[model samples]
Target: MRADRLVSLVLLLRQHGRLSATALARELEVSTRTVLRDIEALSAAGVPVYAERGRHGGFELLPGFRTELTGLNPDEALALLVAGSRRGAQAFGLGSALASAMLKVVDALPESYRDTAAGAAERLLIDPETDLLSRRLVDEEVPDAIAAEVLRAVFAGHKLRIHYAAVDQTPMWRTVDPIGLVTIRDRGYLLATKSGADRTYRLSRILAAKELPEPAQRPDRVDLDRAWQERSTRFRTGGDQVTVLVRVNPGRREDLLGTALAVRAEEPDADGWLRMEVSFQDSRHAKWALWQLSMDAEALAPQWLRDFLRNRATAIATRYGVSS
Candidate 1:
């Protein structure tokens, strides 16, 4: 596909806001004279074009400045607008700002792209629609701008003071120094340095980071990067690891361990029962396996393990219908 002329100009500007004649020419695959002429053309049109000559400097546009969509061909602009809408309404927040932003962009689009935009939108609908609509509103809902600022703060590596809601209490405002923003599964998380000897806060619980002064006491003890690694690994492997040697009927080997503790199935021995070693933790696992496996499991190593299985079985039998 041919590159849109509008997109080409923006790309050039993005790369060469302070670009040398030689550098811009190489980037655009054109002659140095052509690069000089384009710079003049942009400046004559008052496009905020500027350049500097030095070992470390070239062309650069000022930050936070955006060119008008008049630069983009109609079809390209409309396509972006429609695609953005499918992100779900609730996620768009208070003013339905996403839709409004799209309107501005679409208004800028030339007439030629209007029909194509409508046709494309009609054919494409957001499916399996899952988004912020599924959750109950908190203080962040009272003002949506907070959510935007919190995201910005996280990216900036700045401290945040947000009204944080607890699981079973009233929300309280807190100041946290952010370390890293992590995404576990689908949702985003701000891993930050918190007061009272903790250094992390969940973004969902934060109402907004309206203001932040400085860290109360940044932990010199814990390495946040290392802690993040350990936490992520534990999430996959369950809690503390323990090996369970289950003497099971040989043929049931694969199905037993695979369906049970979510461990790799092991090879069976000559005995009619195949001893499967699985990683687990505490007595809770022993109890869970005892009940689920029922007669199939007989703990082989560590006499305590076999005793655990038996004790759990007895407890279940005692607790069955004790309400009477």
Candidate 2:
């Protein structure tokens, strides 16, 4: 493990040119003392490592010193291959580049690992467009030109102007400071800031985009994952959410959960039926999801929901010429 740590330390220095012990420790998830020891070990191991003393000084490798350490074992190689098979890169218009990089990774792998990793990756499927019920997964379509312009702005840390269409609203032009891009369930979103206020725009709804020359005013570093999580939480809790107590067949538990915003509690009854307290966006959402389960699920609380379903079912039966 120390050998691995030393190798990582060297690579970090090589990639970053110089790193303070604190910075190295943070990146390695170890203490500053451990980073110092690793640096000493690398030096004793004939590595050309040196240090400079100043407020802005840290350890640096001598010029032109390189390590031939691939540092990847068979399992690591296999994991990379399998992850590369995902379609996420395609959303960014990098499908061909991903394929080329994967080829190079396989070629660089040890001969014994090369074939095995590739074969294992071939057997694993990810994010298929259809489910077992044969329901087609609808993917939002974004024009390549618009996506390219958005990507340029996000990566370049520039302002972006977009012609956007919001639901049931007129299309309008807006300028935003690009933060990052996120894709969920094949739907792409642009996280941005407008006049210092956070904004999220669906990529599919962007009719056009133009990258601005002005530099965006934003923090030097951003924790994008945290930002996205906070935004998602606000969106989920801000709406008129409805809580429903329902009894559902165990076989349809997943089907019910798929449409629920959150599940408060769940337990199995003596009859093996599942009783769950679930939250939906609103009464309409609850009704729509529960209705899909039909006889398999029953809403116990909220007499109004029961009445609504009963009336609907009765209407349907009467329409079919059956007595309700």
Candidate 3:
């Protein structure tokens, strides 16, 4: 492990030119004492490393000292190949570029690892379009022109203007300070700010986009993952959520949980079924999810929901000329 840490230390100094012990410790997730020991180890091992002392001083590697990428083991190489096989890059219009880079990665690998890594990657599948139930996964479509422009703005730190179509609303033009882009479950989103307020726009809903010349007024550094989580928490908690007590067959428990926002509590009933208190976004969401299970699930509480389901079922039966 220390060998890996020393290799990382050398690479970090090589890449960053110079880094303070505190900075190195932070990046390496170790203490300053550990960093000092690693630096001593590298120097003693014939690495041309030296230190500069001042308020802005740090450890630096001698110029012209570089390391090769041959240190990657078979497993690490395999992991990179498999991760690169994911289709997320396609959402950014970089599918072809990804393919080219992957070839280079495979070529750079040691001969001993090349065939094993490539064969392992070939055996793994990621994000197939259909599931075991033959249900198609939703892949939101974004025009290449629009995606490219949005990507440019986000990377360039420029304001962006877009013609966006919100749900049940007409398309309208708006300007936003581009923050970053996120892709989840094949759906792309633009995380930005409008008038100092956080805003997230689905990329598919962006009818058109333009990169503006003006610089964006955003923070120099951002934790996009934390920002997205906060927004998601707010959205989940702000909705007209409905909690339901339902009893479901054991075999269908996962199907019931798939659509639920949260499961408050669950226990096995004497009948060997699962009694779960589940939360949905609203009454409609609860109705739709429960309807999917048909006889396998039943709503136990909230007489209104039970009545609604009965009435709907009765109406359906009557339509087919059967007595309700």
Candidate 4:
């Protein structure tokens, strides 16, 4: 680990030309003391590292010094840079490493493709904090230590003990055999099992974690995609599923389908509107999702859904009908 940190420190100085010990410490996620010791070690090992003492002083690599890295073609360079810009990897505690690796990648690229690829990457945004609709992305935090432990268990086939807080439930500790880790839309999930029963835990809800010495009680080899698909199918079917028939504006059909868990049936109406039967996790989920379309989509069946929406509309009218 120290070796990696030292290499990263050198790369940072080379790329930036000069950096203060404090800045190096922050970038490397270590203390200034460690950075100073690393600098001494590098210098002792004949690295061309030197310190300047003036007010604008810092550490710098010798002029013309460069480290060689694997050469990447244009497309390959661009892809790596784009991936490094995303926050998804942060959920697994690899944010800093990704950043450092990106730096090395850019520096290692051929001069012809380096600037152009980086410039193209800058114009392409993966997951902005807020989209054009002004919706903030939901990104949860996971402590670096906890994520590291989880990753260790998952990769090494070791059982893990975790203190988890499920939604609306008290925190409890459980020993699970971690199967794999999954990340979607910036949220991370641990696909594991307890007592041989399938279990899924949100990485954000892990309060603490411990790696166990015992080998994990999972299959020697797992097809993550198949496992995830099976779990998703079971979850969609076994939950308190509610179905509703709706007529929606043709233009907003995609919007309606996007919010629903699945569409059971769909057909075009005589009036050119879209008639569809959709499934939601529950009645409340159905109501919340349909309400978003407002006048554009109308729930036509499941009389209770219509009644609930009507009541909701009445309440909204009551609150805003009177202009203060």
Highest lDDT against the true fold, candidate? 4
Which candidate leads in TM-score?
Answer: 4
Let me know the TM-score candidate 3 reaches against the reference structure: 0.68
Candidate 2 residue pairs in clash (backbone atoms < 3 Å)? none
Q: How many residue pairs clash in each candidate?
A: 9, 0, 0, 0
lDDT on C-alpha atoms for all candidate structures: 0.59, 0.84, 0.87, 0.90
Please provide TM-scores, in order, for all candidate models, with all chains considered together: 0.41, 0.65, 0.68, 0.87
Question: Which lDDT tens digits does candidate 4 get at residues 67-120?
Answer: 445567788888999989999998898887788789888877666787788999
RMSD of 1: 16.9
How would the candidate models be sorted by TM-score, starting from the highest?
4, 3, 2, 1
lDDT of 1 at 159: 70
Model 1: per-residue Cα lDDT over 1-324, one tens digit each: 113322354455653355667766775567877666776776776767677768976666675445345567656765676566553333313234555455556544544665567567766655333446875322223345765776556555567778888656799987776655554432455566665443555556777566454433444455657778766565447655556766777655655655454455566667656766676655566556545766766777667877777786788889994986
Q: Which consecutive 10 residues in model 2 have the weakest lDDT in total?
A: 63-72
- Stronger candidate by lDDT (1 vs 2): 2
lDDT of 2: 0.84
Stretches off by above 4 angstroms in model 2 are: 1-73, 107-113, 133-136, 264-277, 300-311, 322-324
In the range 233-276, model 2's lDDT, one tens digit per residue, is 87777678888999999889999989998999998977889989
